[model samples]
Target: MKSKNTMFLVQAATIGAIYVVLTLLFAPLSYGEVQVRFSEALTILPYFTPAAIPGLFVGCILSNLLGGAIPVDIIFGSIATLIGAVFTYKLRGSSKWLAPLPPIVANTVIVPFVLYYGYGVNLPIPLMMLTVGAGEVISCGIFGMIVLTALSKVKGSVFGKASYSK
Candidate 1:
């Protein structure tokens, strides 16, 4: 039982670290209105492990902070990630294809307003929404799905059957 708890902590920490590193590595494309955050792909991990919820939330918060985002963007963006991760975990019993939807939708709907009110960007809200949505689709929808597929193949080795909840 102690070893099981240790695995959960290690997994969550590793996921969060990967997310932060990915965002920083792609700093140029990880922020702004028109952006594709590669870290968004990890949002799908919740489909396998509940640890992904807090992992993603903490990662987004750290990424936003290091990326020099405003307070509103940091707070709301982290909240958006939290919401998405929760929904993804909840939808785990459904089709694997559906796991990424929450992050894509949450960011698409929330980020435009952040760009407008939070950062005071002059771009029209609708346009920002479109751009952010497209980025999310690429990151969360396309890339996330690919990540999920790849992870599925190696899940038993990487995560062990006991790592995930039934």
Candidate 2:
């Protein structure tokens, strides 16, 4: 039991660190209107382990801090990721194809407002949604699907049997 808990913590921390590092690597592209955060690809991890929820949330918070986000973006943006991770965890057992939808949807819905109000972008809401959603689709959907496929092969080694709660 103790070892299992330790493993869970280690996995979560490692995921968080990876997320922060990836976000930092793409800082310039990640902060702007057309954000293609490579880190968003990790959002699919919740499909394999509940630990991914806190992992992704903390990672988003840390990434936002490092990215020098505004206060509203820091608060609300993290909230969006938290919500998305929770949704992903809930849908963990359904299908791998559905895993990345939570983050993509969450970011799509929330980020448009953040761009318009927080960043003071003058674009229309529909345009913001399209752009942000497209970014998420590419990052969380396309790249994330590729990652999910690769991770699925290693799920047993990384997350263990009970990790797939479905």
Candidate 3:
């Protein structure tokens, strides 16, 4: 029991740290209107374990903070990630293709507001939504699917049979 809990913590921490590193490494393309945070590919991790919910939330917060995001972005962006991850975990049993929808929708719906009001961007809300949604499609939809595929192939070897229940 203790070992299980430890493993969960370790996985979450590792995911969060990787997210931060990816975001920082691709700092320029990780934020803003036309952006694709490659770390978002990991959003699909929640489909494998509940640990990814908080892992993604904390990671987004840290990434935004260290990347010099405004307070609104730090708060709302993290909230978006939290919402996405929770939904992804909840919807995991539905379908593999559906796993990335929550995060994509959450970011699409929420990020435009942050960019317009929070950052004082001049783009129209609809346009901002389009851009953000496009980016999410690239990161969460495309890259996330890629990650899911790779993870599925090695689930038994990497995450154990417990994660294969889905």
Candidate 4:
């Protein structure tokens, strides 16, 4: 039990750090109206590890803080990712293809509103959806699929068989 708790903390911390680094890496592109957070690919990890729930939440929170997002965006944006990560974790073992969808959908649905209200973007809803959805499909879907495939090969070595069980 103690070891499991420690492992969870370690995973969360690592995920948070990686998220911060990745957000900083794309600082210019990740903020403002159109966001392409390549690090969001990690969101799919929740499908394989429950640790990804808090891991993704903390990661989003930290990344938002570092990225200088507005307070509302920091709070609600993190909530969006947290909700998506939890959903993904709950749906673990369903299908690899479906693992990344929750984050993509969550961000797509919530972020457009944020861009319009928060950033004062006057773009149409369809355009917002297209841009945000495209970024998520590329980041969380394409890149996430690659990460999922790579992790599948070393599932036992990294997270263990128990971690991958539904």
Candidate 5:
């Protein structure tokens, strides 16, 4: 029992750490109107374990903070990630192709507001939505699917069968 809890914590922490690293490493492309956050590729991770929900939420918060985002952007942007992660985890039993849709939709719907009001980005909301959606499609939709595919091939070896039932 103790070991299970410990493993859950470890997995969550590892995911959060990796998210921060990826976001910062691709800092230029991780934030802004025309951005493609590489860390978003890991958004598919919630499909493996529910631990990813909080991991991704905290990771987005930390990433936005370290990236010098305004308070509004930090708060709302993180919320978007939280919502997406939750939905992705909830859909774990569904088709693997659906894993990326949650984040893509969540970010596309929420990020435009963050960019326009929070960051004072001059683009129209529709334009921002288009750009942000495009980026999400690339990161969450495309790269996320790729990661999902690779992880599915080795789920037991890496994340463990225990994760699925959790």
Candidate 6:
């Protein structure tokens, strides 16, 4: 494979690994109907690099899988992350504040259904949306913004080129 491709794969894999770590580290708050997954903050990374798109998706997948999520949650939850990451990438040149909105909205909308049908959580969809939305706001909006701001400073250095030195 070319150096660029290799670098891209490495970046994506690293992001996925980090996502798994964060989700597992915060196991209690990383699952269930009311979850504040700290890993969701990494969803903002798509704004910096396209590699983050796949990275976040695969990361969510492994996180859910290892977190013992049900089949529906594993599939749908990852899809939400993937959709959010794609939109985030599309909005890369737009306002940074909007970067986190996609994941927040995606998760808020999709996760409630996963909770209700997948986990058999007994809660009104709207209520679940509210709770999930709140979590997303905390994770994706607030925490993601913190990460985004810090990453923006090192955007060129970190997301730029691979040294290709081995």
Instruction: Give, for candidate 3, the lowest lDDT window spanning 10 residues.
Output: 157-166
Per-residue accuracy of model 6 over 71-161 as CA lDDT, tens digit each:
9999999999999999988888778889999999999999999999888899999999999999999999999999998877666788884
Q: What TM-score quantifies how close candidate 1 is to the native fold?
A: 0.95
Model 4 reaches what TM-score against the true structure? 0.94
RMSD values, in order shown: 1.9, 1.5, 1.3, 1.5, 1.9, 4.2
lDDT of 2 by residue, 85-158 (tens): 89988888787788889999999999889989999999997888898889899989999989888877777876
List, residue by residue over 1-166, the lDDT tens digit for candidate 3. 8988887888889889999999999999999987898999889899988878888999999999999999999999899999999999888777799989999999999999999999999999999899999999999999999999899988866554444434
Angstrom error of the Cα, residue 56, model 6: value is 0.8
lDDT of 5: 0.89
Residue 70 lDDT (model 2): 91
Count residue pairs with overlapping backbones in model 4. 0
lDDT of 1 by residue, 1-166 (tens): 9998898888889899999999999999999999999999999999988878888999999999999999999999999889999999989888888889999999999989999999899999999989999999999999999999898878878766723323
Span of 10 residues, lowest total lDDT, candidate 4: 157-166
Candidate 3 regions exceeding 4 Å error are: 161-166
User: Any runs in candidate 4 off by more than 4 Å, and if so which?
Assistant: 163-166
List of clashing residue pairs for candidate 6: none
TM-score of 3: 0.96
What would you estimate as the lDDT of candidate 1?
A: 0.91
Clashes of each: 0, 0, 0, 0, 0, 0
lDDT of 4 by residue, 47-72 (tens): 77778788889889888988888888
Of 5 and 6, the candidate ranking higher by lDDT: 6
